[model samples]
Target: MYLIAIAWMYVVVMMTIAEAASPGGTLLGAFFTLVLYGLLPLSILLYILGTPARKRRIKARQAQEAPAEGHPPSGTSSGVAPDARSQPPAAAQTDSVSPVREES
Candidate 1:
């Protein structure tokens, strides 16, 4: 990758030099040509090339994490404590509340 970047830099430098030397081309035109034709396309190409590797790395990291997450601490089998685990769900407490009647 470094070699490719260095080679591209050399190509751009040579192009800019040639443009500047040409009777019809200005230094400003050379700068724009290097930015528009050279750097922009190279940047897009590098991004497209790197995307799959980036996604693979992310998936590999997630896969590594999944196993670690599967097993819990020895002290706690479930996320809740032993005492809390014995209790019924909070939603079951609705029996103790009186329902409100709507007034028209």
Candidate 2:
């Protein structure tokens, strides 16, 4: 993906140079060609194409920072530690705000 972007930028740079060297082409035209034809579209394309990679990087970093199974991070859990508890909480002792209904 990056290789493609680099190749494209190289092409655009050459095109910009050709534009600047042309008899009728102005420096302003070259600058506009570089920016409008090269930088803008390439930036948007790379960002869109790199979405999955960015997401993967984020997930990988989070996974590395995440605590191991059965071991919660410090100061994040409320009350007693999950491993320290010997029994489950009562069914009625839920934190749900919605009322339960019985089936007919």
Candidate 3:
């Protein structure tokens, strides 16, 4: 994420440099044009810093995946695996039925 931000900043800086190279209102015009183009890195900067959804998802994902109380996840185990039948099914339940069910 930091790398993305850094790259975004780099693009923004390059844009500012390009704008500086241009003369008169042309530079400013080009600046606005750059903004008009979605490729402008400023949006990415704002999104990385400003968007609540991105922030919340990042926080939630980090929390959900973090190592808990000094116990790491058991990914390297060589022991016998547990029986699958003992565990409950992990399928999603759907409440919405087919349109035909409405008639019934």
Candidate 4:
């Protein structure tokens, strides 16, 4: 995946450089060439090639989750009860810290 992305970038950079070096080629023209000829096709190719991998990952995740779906989640690994996890501590419940300081 990374290799494809890197290779695409290299090709695009080289193409941009070539376009910039061509007779009567402006930097703006090079930019447009890079976008049109390099990035557009590369992006489309990556998306098409990546579809199956993405689908497989999603399917694997769903399969792993299916078994655990029927069971209720247990308490935290640290042994904190469900009740403690549901509520904030007493200090956090009140706005004890004032933003403005009174002049002495």
Candidate 5:
């Protein structure tokens, strides 16, 4: 699916070239609009196909692959409690951060 989108980028570029080289200027204008309209959606689709989505996809896939409760295939974070375990999630702790203590 992702490969299809990636290839579509090249296809769009080639289409642009073809549209430019086309004999009928009206055909070129119509194809140019098509390529313009497709560019944003294609870039977004490609990005989703690429790295950011890949991580979540792999994690979700692994979790689905294993059929056990409380076993989420050991993500970047540990399965244990922050206090019990060595490292804690960033959002979990608040002591290190200070209050604003604003004045009028």
Candidate 6:
């Protein structure tokens, strides 16, 4: 892919040089030709084509940086105390007073 891009850029550079050297061609036109024809499209194409590689690199890096599966991350717990493991959840209280409604 890079080889193709390089070849394409070479062709565009030659075209730019020809445009610049032509009797009626302005240097500004040649510059625009190089940038518009060569740089912008090539950059966009490379970025689009390289997406899968970028994703793979990111995934590999994440896998490498991840902790082992056997151990949990630090600063986090299972939320249950060791001694409370045998206890059942407490029932809700039923002693609260009920709301009084107007006689209307």
**C-alpha lDDT values of all predictions:** 0.77, 0.82, 0.58, 0.76, 0.68, 0.81
lDDT of 6 by residue, 1-104 (tens): 99999999999999999999999999999999999999999999999999999999997776666564533333324433334454423442246788999998
Candidates in descending TM-score order: 6, 2, 4, 1, 5, 3
TM-score for all models, in order of appearance: 0.55, 0.64, 0.30, 0.56, 0.35, 0.65
Per-residue C-alpha lDDT of model 2 across residues 1-104, encoded as one tens digit per residue: 98999999999999999999999999999999999999999999999999999999997876677655454555434444444464433542568688889899
On the 0 to 100 scale, the lDDT of residue 41 in model 3 is: 56
**Candidate 1: where is the Cα deviation over 4 Å?**
1-5, 71-104
- Predicted candidate 4 versus true structure: per-residue lDDT over 1-104, tens digit per residue: 76977888898899889889999888998999888877888889889998999999997887778557753334333233335557644544666776997799
lDDT of 3: 0.58
After TM-score superposition, the amount by which residue 92's alpha carbon in candidate 2 deviates from its true location, in angstroms, is 7.6
Query: Candidate 2 has which clashing residue pairs, if any?
Result: none
Q: What is the lDDT of residue 104 in candidate 3?
A: 44
Regions more than 4 Å wrong, model 3: 23-25, 33-104
> How does residue 76 of candidate 5 score in lDDT?
41
Better of 3 and 5 by TM-score: 5
Between 2 and 4, whose lDDT is larger? 2
Off by over 4 Å in 2: 68-104
How should the candidates be ordered by lDDT, best one leading? Answer: 2, 6, 1, 4, 5, 3
| Pairs with backbone N, CA or C atoms under 3 Å apart (clashes), candidate 6 | none
lDDT of 4: 0.76
Q: Which stretches of candidate 6 lie over 4 Å from their true place?
A: 68-104
- RMSD, candidate 6, Å: 8.5
Q: If both were scored by TM-score, which would come out higher, candidate 4 or candidate 5?
A: 4
**Model 5 CA deviation exceeding 4 Å by range:** 26-38, 50-104
lDDT of 1 by residue, 32-95 (tens): 8789868997898789878999999997887788669885434544544455566645544356
Q: What digit string (tens of lDDT, one per residue) describes model 5 on residues 7-90?
A: 877777667767766786466575765567567788776777687778989978878876555554464445545554656777
Report lDDT (Cα) of residue 103, candidate 4: 100
Best by lDDT: 2
